[model samples]
Target: MIKTFKSSLFLCAMSALFLCSACHKEQSPIPEVLGEYLKYHAEKGKTADGYDAYFDLSDGMLAAYSNDTTKAEIKSIINKITGNKNCRNIYSLKEGTVSKLDKSQTELYNYILNPSSYATVAPIEETLKRITSQGTSAFLVTDFEEYSNGVIQQQNYAKAYFVDWLKKGGDITFFITNYLENGKQKHLYFTVFDMGEHSLLKDIENALEGSKSKYTRFNLTANVVDIEYGYSGTKGGCYHDESGEDIVSVTNESGEGDCFTLYKDYHAEYYPFNETWANIVKNAKDLSEEGNTPKFMHLITGPKVNLTSLSGYNVKELDLKVTNIQDDFIRFAGYYEYTKDKTINVDENGKLLDEYNYPNKNNATNMPEIEDMLKYAGCVQDGVATLNVDFDKDFNGTSSKVKPLDLLRVDIVIDECEPKYDLITKLFSWEGNNSLEQAVRNTLQEVNPEGQVIYTFFMRDGGE
Candidate 1:
């Protein structure tokens, strides 16, 4: 999730030792380019949701802030602290690795500081090479801009390179330092911070060991925090134009709401709840314009059984571990389209009371788990590009014959609403004996009278 906010980034002076040296006449006069670097993130990490801001660099790009005077002051401080006399453009490092770089290190930087290239691609040659051989640590990677002949282009490989880098040997929390790359970017030095951890595999293990319930539904929910999406990271954001994939687009360019939508299934008519923690949803997955059709929305490794209402019924959290099965993976995806008239709010998990007093997620907020009810409908691509989970631990279903079913909940916390979406739950009462399609039509009239958004789930391939 790459953010592009406009404000001065407050620099808290830190005491980290950087390896800098004096430059010769051939080197660019710029003392040192200060900026943040992104580390390799794997798809097989732990899984947990709730506002977990990568306080560690906010990890993804967000916000649009810029302050030159303040930034200059920070750079001055860095020069005094590090005593680094050499300054060079980000491209200089690409000429070749600095002699002082540690073994297997690739000195790269990104145009992350660039608002225009924020959504576009970037160069990763030097960095990608490192991952292929002995592991490498990059100073900068996806933030550079390249112009060929008269065309403006970016080399989009940081993500793939990072995945490969993690496999070889990567550190979630590593070291970084920024420099005065140019007039636009000031001295942005790197400091260490916490990169929240998640182990989807571990979550599953714990769930299975806890308890069991005959009510076989895996009620899952993705509390979306923030939406920093778009292929255009220029001054004003733009749409994604690059092509080469499989996600089929439903609508072309509409006026206000989502101009494009890719539904996961005819069932889950709803969404892409990327990643979380800070109540902020930052996507770390690779997003392409082509992969639009929802073909992979199943929690393949989950229990096998019949399910009841997700939030309507009482059940154990452990049953929702659709993520526990080895080789199989869990994916939470959906489409969403927000227009000026149709507004929605994503409320996080809070504390509340059920029929009986207890600490339940429902207690925290009104967002209920989607169970045997209407699925979903939205407009947009799937969630983030890099969320993947594969469990290797050994475990048998709660019962050899009776497999538990997994059903996730996606709470749509609607705030100050438009007339049509008033008191959405009213539709839940209309689930009469009519076919789901008919029920949906009537429900849509009550909730989304104008068809703002809908909810449906994607059944995993061959999944009952």
Candidate 2:
């Protein structure tokens, strides 16, 4: 998730390969080995995007050919990207030891592992060619809050699995989220890092952890689409009572009363709805379809941060002992009131407008653009977006009823970062000039005292 790529691959290579290689036949100059690598990958034709093929000559010597005199100054930088405290883990893989690597991985690993023996070995250029050409990606969904002080540093497959993916020209994108059920914070993390770059983050692993939180509706009722009408369902006319008595169901010409008045001249068949209800639905659907830009009443109580644009509710007071069944998800029974008012039109229906703008489906919108909202919360990666907004709406005969827990579940879709090609494997077996190689290493470390400097060797095959 960090923006700046760290050059820690050599460190991992040293640990995994120092003993296995003809690499340790004697002390090879740091610059020579590395410079040779850049030249070699270029000769074989590889791309490096904007990332130039270079090495921190000093860092390589300290880690691979010398002692550990420096530490990576990147803890604070890592936290900036991951939203976690310390840099949890930066997993890498080395030659001959990548787990579950396919045939292509095996060939590439072998070639890099024994450069001395590579003359007899055929090139795995086709595998690398296919990978870089087609391109691949990863979607790493994480619940970073679950980490203790934001640390997930026990580097195993859980952390390092993406390395092989990157090697195969797959880029990675991370989606970090905190889990919640029944409005209670789970204080847990459920993540899935897909090399195949699947959008869904595997499963929502349920576990009993710290404390639980439930969504409490503070009687915050929204008047979603208020409609003033004469009479909708069964506009009364002449009707017989259960006792076989003739009865009339209104006192005035307007369809407004429920009392049975004396019946003399009443003759109108029952109709179920009025123009008011039809117009209300039509207006609501239109409002939502055209990008819910208008404000509506949104009622929420307490210390939860809504990382979405569907905010700004008309605050109200309420008290209701809601669904008490213990569960790990927020239950919804969408049913908001449609109060009959003295006036008969869809005018300034305030807070109710707000709720329906984001939650109402089966009307104007079937999906909510929550990904746009996620950019503020750091679910940021260009081209990477989320899909499938899971929400439910209640309706009574074409009239939508908004209720508790009308929410858009937090999930993301990321277009994976394409792996950058590097021309590091172009190094071919050539008799080394010992004095020249030694002079290169001495100059490599002697450049600048402040830190290791990048000593780029112009790739032999014009790789970049």
Top candidate by lDDT: 1
TM-score of 2: 0.17
TM-score of each: 0.21, 0.17
| Clashes in predicted model 1 | 85
Regions of candidate 2 where Cα sits further than 4 Å from its true position = 1-284, 288-327, 330-410, 415-418, 421-464
lDDT per residue, candidate 2, 1-464, as tens digits?
Answer: 11111111122222221322321222222223332333333223223221100011111112221211111111111222232222122221222111222223234233223323222111112222322343322111121111123332222222122233333423322211223334433211112222231222121111111113221111001111111222223222222234322222111223333122111111101111112322333433444454444411111101111211111122111111111111111111101111222121113542333222213443333333222211111222232211112112331112122111122222221212221112100110112212212322232223211211111101000001
Kindly give the stretch of ten consecutive residues in candidate 1 with the minimal lDDT sum: 30-39
lDDT for each residue of candidate 1 in 1-464, tens digit (9 for 90 to 100): 21111111111111111111221111111001000001112212312221111111111122211334323322332222222222111221222231222211111112223344333222234434532353222223222222244333333323344334333333222111122233332122121111123232122223323222111221111111132232221111111223422121111223222122222221112111211111110111122224733323322111111112121112121111121111011101000111111111111232111221212224322323323222212212222111112211232112222122222233222221222222222221122212212322232333321211122122111112
Task: Judge candidate 1 at residue 193 and give its lDDT.
Answer: 14
